[model samples]
Target: MEPPELRRAVAAGRVAASELGLQVDDVVVVHNSDRVALRLVPCDVLARVAPVGHLADSEFEVEVARRLNAVDAPVAELDPRVEPRVFLRDAFAISLWTYYEPAESEIAPTDCADAFLRLHAALRHIDLEAPHFTDRVAVALGEVNDRERSPDLPESDRELLSGTLSGLSATISTEHDRDQLLHGEPHPGNLLNTRRGLLFVDLATCCRGPIEFDLAHAPEEVGDHYKGADPVLIHRCRALNWAMFSAWRWRRADQMPDRDRWRATGLDNVRAALDRCHLD
Candidate 1:
């Protein structure tokens, strides 16, 4: 979103929060991409603002959080001050969450693995209907295949991404017996080091897939600590993850920070992963 649109979204979030009887003295942007996350001051509530069209996705995230909280899973919780639901204001979809103060120390790989294991255990009991991991791959595949959507992507690069996504998706799809709800993108960025501990956020990407698919998003060393993880499957999923991210970065409408740098890095990672797989 442009600066003006982002300002409008923040304003919308502030209005929504105020309506919930929270006193907001100031607003601080937590992050900005396709959506904006703002920290409402004094109240210490985090408000996630996205285009109103994303209402369904926001609603899904809230539901996922509620279920996770119910099972005492290590995930961010919705704000107790407001109804646990998506609030629409102006042209933005706003959702309030409890904001955790950041911890001074970073989460260690082993700790991350342990938290992820506990999360997976709790997720096993969740019965929510979610998209399959292939559905996510298809979305990226669609972007790469659409020339207009990825106008800046070179034809050769597009082909590389397309092939990688297709092959890995097919290979991973065969593991239906191991299919279960996954945190979709459990990378370091999504894991918050908070006062409570390392709690995972961004539940919007929740999907059904093999555990290795989720592990692929974490640091390589994390898989070492996560016992029973299939190394080969994790490697394959890592390639797929890179390809998907590369596709997203190439989108003509993507506004992620440092997108160009990430696009180049993603392509490199994908190629490197593929080469390693070939050697193995």
Candidate 2:
């Protein structure tokens, strides 16, 4: 949909601007995206709306934002007023999460460790059970489909993906004891540093699953393949997600020669790290 139609719908009503303290002339369309922010207009107070896509649980983001507001995690300190809202369209989940104020990246290990402990505790309490391959699997697989067209992806690249899929599939029947909601994608960028210290912003990826998902995804150190704030596991996950993310992005646009190759490299790196963890 073009921005005009969506923006028009969002502007057609009197939304409760009290949260944003918008003056009558203040910008009502403070944000715009294919996601469900359009329905946040005054016209639809009961339901929030965003673009139609994966993981649009109309209620999840708001619930997550509320919990994040209450939790004392480091990522919580730097997030914007996260008032996520849910909406339904054509039987699709649509939600919106506000982007916090932009600032420099001044994150530290203290914040990572502190946020990790707090989030782990939260996941321990929440209920997260599942019956099928998670949405991420869908997204990851979707990327694999799009990548098939590239003329240069090596056989090994395809093999690595085969391994990733197989590993993920094997876990489908393997259940864990402790279960709770988790941010399947937890990285440094999801957190911010601000007056509050560290604030977590993204919750669209939250799902019911093993608490170890967060623990495994959490930033930690490895004697090897080290760089930035993310530890080895997080680094590996980052590479995989990036390959998937890049594939998705590339599919949206044109193709890149280096893309398929780099994606393969990322997959190999991720698998190596996971091997170190004995999870792959």
Candidate 3:
């Protein structure tokens, strides 16, 4: 959505909240991407608006958080007073959540790993249907090869991405680790060290996969801290994730401030992953 349209949607969200008896004295834009986050003040609530088709994943995230909270899991809590339902208006889907303020210091990788382990355990109890982790891998590869999606992607890099994705998929399919519910991306960026301690947010990527898949985005220290983690599987997952992320960067390079820098770094990571896989 464009700036004017997003501002309109944010206004619509505030009005929608008012209808539900939630008073919004102010509205602050927290983040914007595929979705827009508005921090509704006085009530201290968050309103997230996304396109219609995208609501399902956001709804799933809310339900998963509800279940995890029941188990005393350390995750971003939803506003329980309001029914967690996706509201549709003007082609946008909105959901309300309790706002969280992070501490001054960033959350350490060790904290992220510890919180992820707890969150993962609680998520296993959620019996909802979720996409497999590899499903995203396929999607990323698709974007890399799609001319309209990645019009600037070089032919040589496209071939390299395709080949690397196939090899990674093969390795993932043969891994011996037990599959379970995963936080999907447990990197430090997705975690917050709040007054309540470390809380995992952005459950939209929650999926069913080997625990190593969740650890792939985390720092090496995080992988080391996680007990019973399969080192070899973690390494393989890292290689796979790097390839996928590299494709993602390439696909969205146009929107980045430093496209050349990002493209260079992404391609470098892709090459590194390919080299590591060959060594193995």
Q: What is the full ranking by lDDT, best candidate first?
A: 1, 3, 2
How close is every model to the real structure, measured as TM-score? Answer: 0.98, 0.58, 0.90
Which is the winner by TM-score between candidate 1 and candidate 3?
A: 1
lDDT of 2 by residue, 89-178 (tens): 443444434334455665556656666656656655544443232456666656555556533445566555646654543453253334
Best by TM-score: 1
**For residue 119, what is the lDDT in candidate 3?**
79
Record all residue pairs in model 3 with backbone atoms less than 3 Å apart, i.e. clashing.
Answer: none
lDDT of each: 0.93, 0.47, 0.78
Best by lDDT: 1
After superposition, the stretches of candidate 1 with alpha carbons farther than 4 Å from their true spots are none
Candidate 1 structure quality by residue, lDDT tens digits, 145-213: 999999999999998999999988998898645989999999888999999998999999999999999
Colliding pairs, model 1: none
Name the better of 2 and 3 by lDDT: 3
List candidate 2 segments past 4 Å from native: 1-21, 24-49, 52-55, 67-84, 87-105, 128-135, 142-156, 168-179, 210-212, 215-219, 222-280
Give the lowest summed-lDDT range of ten residues in model 1. 271-280
Runs in model 3 lying further than 4 Å from the true structure = 252-261, 274-280
